[model samples]
Target: MADKSSSNAYWKANIRMIQLFLVIWFVVSFGFGIILRPMLSGIAVGGTDLGFWFAQQGSILVFLVLIFVYAWRMNRLDKEHGVEE
Candidate 1:
């Protein structure tokens, strides 16, 4: 495309998406897995401590969703901005 603003729009959108996802990822893994885990120790998941579940399983699930969300959003944004190529 000859439009520079359109290219910038794509970068900005992707940047925001990546930043938000990383923050969420950090909060779930480091925060729930280690830092704030004690506060959640009383909770259980599949008969295990919630923090342990987060460390072992929940983070993986979140990462899956994050990847799918990024793909879907990128596809939509690409079409919206005529940058699918």
Candidate 2:
């Protein structure tokens, strides 16, 4: 029972982290890239609107950063939960 509760807590934390990252991904890739693009147009990047930059490259860069962040965070979480590999 003890082990089961610990495992459940670990999984819950893991899922919560994933959900947060996914929301950020969606906002960056879709919201900034399309829906909120017009609002961001006033901001320029490399002679173009910020939205264009996000649609073309910024989102990909953000995704890469998020991947690393997730890895680093999850590794720390694993260590905290005594499940590091």
Q: Please name the candidate that would achieve the greatest TM-score relative to the true structure.
A: 2
Clashes of 2: 0
Model 1 agreement with the true structure over 1-85: per-residue lDDT tens digits: 5888998988898899999999999989999988999999899788888899989989899989999998999899989888887
TM-score for each predicted model, relative to the true structure: 0.90, 0.91
Q: What is the lDDT of residue 82 in candidate 2?
A: 79
Candidate 1 overall lDDT versus native: 0.91
In order of listing, the candidates' clash counts read 0, 0
Q: List candidate 2 segments past 4 Å from native.
A: none
Worst 10 residues of 1 by lDDT: 1-10
